[model samples]
Target chain A: MSARRIVALSGGVGGAKLADGLMRVLPQDTLTVVVNTGDDFRHLGLHISPDIDTVLYTLCGLANPETGWGRRNETWQFMQALASLGGETWFRLGDADLAMHIERTRRLDSGQKLSSIVADCAHRLGIRAEVLPMTDAPVRTRVDTTEGRLDFQDYFVRRQCAPVVSGLRYDGAARAEPVHSAVAAIRSAAAILICPSNPYLSIAPMLAVPGLRQALRDAEAPVIAVSPLINGAAVKGPTAKIMAELGLPVCAPEIARHYGDLIDGFVLDERDAALADQIDIPVCLADTLMKDIDDRERVARASLAFAERLRAEMIA
Target chain B: MSARRIVALSGGVGGAKLADGLMRVLPQDTLTVVVNTGDDFRHLGLHISPDIDTVLYTLCGLANPETGWGRRNETWQFMQALASLGGETWFRLGDADLAMHIERTRRLDSGQKLSSIVADCAHRLGIRAEVLPMTDAPVRTRVDTTEGRLDFQDYFVRRQCAPVVSGLRYDGAARAEPVHSAVAAIRSAAAILICPSNPYLSIAPMLAVPGLRQALRDAEAPVIAVSPLINGAAVKGPTAKIMAELGLPVCAPEIARHYGDLIDGFVLDERDAALADQIDIPVCLADTLMKDIDDRERVARASLAFAERLRAEMIA
Candidate 1:
């Protein structure tokens, strides 16, 4: 098969896994991951981009396999010290992981844009693929929980996701301009794949950026989304809980409907084959449970094939 | 003796030891240490007050006994990670010590004054003595070396004090305002004791601040200084090297001479008693090596008694 430029829209952990799969199956320098920066927040006075770091570590094979987040063999001395100092320690930042936040904060303070810093970090860490923040400007996700309005990190880390999330908003998304490089990547991609991340939490924030979805619509390629659930349950995080809290059924069809016409195809796990027929969009079933590198590559290949089939059908 | 408020001027390590000694010997809340901020530089975009921290750690009994710097049992994971990320790692910031820098930087960024932050930290850490930065404003020490002019930390840490010191200047001393509490502490002090810190590098920066020496002169209390040298050599750091580079002899007499008109008396180590009678104002000898806790308390008592002697003579 000929090498093609693939663009992946993703969030943290779960999404990073599929992005890793794409990196493994795809050729070098042919992948571009536009990660959601809505989860980016200031922690301990340092700029922390959770999803960007997740994807960077995943693609570079530096992520902890067990946690599926942060760096492997990480130390927690910094967090311990912070706790001892009576500082906020709910969001545990590992010592090695702190380097990312410190460097990012320093550069950001010095007027460097997030995209440039990410690019430089990627290059320095020997990441072959391009990993971009969705927007350089602040676009923090504010979770409207049953307890009241809280920042994304407050709801997720500090509250331990106990607060029932009713609604979410990307605070600065309306005014935030999409990254030029991300838009260019989408415009020229052979196919754009949305990873198995929470539809409302991750993917929607990216689409909320004005002209971002328009870039997808204007692109001369098929756009596909992978269902985040396996057997009607999310592998990790509050995806399932958030869905139930919003009074929506936790199923593949609902995720497909959430994406709607923006996607040309939707890929579900093999266990959810029955639900695939219920989705109005063109649907494909594959093994979406990416437990290992080989499993990820397999799912990535199947998803790409499904995208190619949709493109062929449109041409016919 | 009745409890009397005492003001102490200090720098780092060596000064911190004597400050700790003062804390041990004096009544609670009787001591206020005005630490030099000239060595404070923005490293990795964090506001780090080294001398201020040393004072805080020492008074609170949190300092590493061997290094006489930073918190006890500190971990270097952050420094290791920073180095791996290609960050400037010449000045090693331990994981526990990083909390101080991060918190300080955050508060400073939010427009909180350094003196207020130090006071709060000292209170939190259970330090009975007050710890104050020399000034609220930036008063950086710049060393004019044979190699060229360099920032304090750049010369002290990165260059390992190898540069031949030609001169020293406090960059913002003239424009920097003295902390109101420190000035008040000096004016109302029962006695003022200058710790065994480098004359040019440490204590000089404090004196360089306009009206600081005036406050000492205006006070009715006597002022005394402890020599950093034991015999003819400094206990640690570049005190001897800088003294030699500046064409000054490294001896207790030179240090006493440096404090000439400012000090009412001078305190030299018992080992340097042989060289003390070279036409000095008033001199006292005590154990100044400070190898252990008892040594610290002993020196503190002797220095305070010397201040009392000077006060008695002035009254007579």
Candidate 2:
């Protein structure tokens, strides 16, 4: 069959880059992106899902290339006005970005599922690839830190992620079942790819969804993951800092260790190619930091080629 | 006593203009504006008082002069995005305007009264003119039309006031008592001046609140109303069309008759000077169209002079 189904797991920005790459290389309907909702929260009475917006913006080519998130040419009038009115605008949701939140909140209030809202948004933005939330239910990533247990945005934006992370928990993950489309996409996939995103913050929350992790383990398709950590640093965000704060080694091998049996094949940065033997899973090395549109596409092509090679080896 | 007090009853846009003029002429604490809240509605799950914001924006000098409402130099990126997402953008709420709605909604949801939120907003904007809503309760102005009864905005905005008005009704006015500050200002004023706003649509709702009309009648102050129907047309909005549809003449005397015993003095346009003598109330004629800031100030000066003249006549 010509239908080559590829399911990609993603968070915001960094992960969205890989998801974009995968979408570019694969056929339109061949790709399904399951986004992390751990960073989702209600702000100003609107349900704001940060990672979902990022993935949608990235896929539709509306995301700001400079910031790697939010819409390009976005205005801060709303945030400035919000600050003037004493509204908590620490998360910096831009004016154009707010429309998405408002519409999503309205839809949710009208009893539409998060997955359906995302799918509709993606479709309206001319995105042919499916976009699905990890779960239909609310699940937040809470950082159990020395200061206290902080909500994802409270720790990330309000405190500037300065708190020392003792551990992380996907609050309500036990009750969250994977969205039917998300599960079907994974089960029907010829190959599954986990985008290079923060293990503790992004990917873990999705993996923590009860039936999700087990479904991946039981899937017929081989699961491949690209390391977010390269050498001793993350390409972006506080992934490396968080890993170090958690007393975990800040290296590619440690990223592989974090995933454990969830990953059947692993891709690491060329800088950490020498450390491949130390990683338990079979590995490939490539440049994973997607700086431009071409870079995103190349990284995606590289990941898919590497995954196919691994699948061939498994068959042999 | 250098503590001269001036009380003005107002609605949005035209009312805001007079309130702004009053703030410019009087001492900060001397002026009190009782704004109509009948236009207020919950939209996108946010409690939005259009008249309150209009007064606030005008007083802050942040109001758009061209439209006579909303913030100046506002961007519609959010509204454009909202339209793209199939959300309602008929209200033309700019991003900065959305901030006000969002903040108001947030405070309203936090168990704060509408009166307190308006006070907080006024305090934040450095407006000391005591901007108070007609009532804290939710009172929607519903127009009984040939097309059927529709919400105020739906009749005024969505349909562009094209529907013929049979009558107007204040939905919750029967149970609503006037705000204490509003009642106190009316009772304490040496003279009460109503702004040049629609008598039926804008001022009628304010009068409809239980016991407010009686309070106005009982107050020792001489009440004066600036005619919204100047000459044979409304300065702005649908007042003329509504008057014609409701079988009332589109002229200043007809406007004065609507207020009847509620007002002791009437201010009309120079074009409507001939019709002024037809009314029983004491009448003054001058340029009432606020074409510019200078016009607003000039009209305000005239209105104040007329009020003092009426006060003298009452004493005589």
True-structure lDDT of candidate 2: 0.87
lDDT of 1 by residue, B1-316 (tens): 3588888999998898889999988999999999999999998899888889988888888898777678888877777766666777888888878888998888888899999989988888889998999899999999999899999999988898998999999999988889999999888888999999998999999999987878987888999999899878988888988888889888889988988888999998889878978736899988899888888888889999999989989999
In candidate 1, the residue pairs with backbone N, CA or C atoms under 3 Å apart (3 or more residues apart, or in different chains) clash, namely none
State, as a TM-score between 0 and 1, how close model 2 is to the true structure: 0.97
Expressed as tens digits, the lDDT of each residue in B1-316 for candidate 2 is: 1356788889888888888887787766888898898888877766778888989999888998888678899899998998888887778888999889988888888888888889888989989789899898878999999999999989987898998899999999988988988888888887788898778888889999976777789878788898887768887888899989999888889988989888999988888888977898788888988877778787787888898888888889
Worst 10 residues of 2 chain A by lDDT: A1-10
- How many steric clashes between backbone atoms does each model show? 0, 0
Predicted candidate 2 versus true structure: per-residue lDDT over A166-195, tens digit per residue: 999999998899998888888988889999
Q: What is each candidate's DockQ, to 2 decimals?
A: 0.63, 0.81
Fnat for model 1 comes to 0.58
Highest lDDT among the candidates is held by which one? Answer: 1
Candidate 1 docking category? medium
lDDT of each: 0.88, 0.87
Error of 2 at B190 (Å): 1.4
Instruction: Name the regions of candidate 2 deviating beyond 4 angstroms.
Output: none
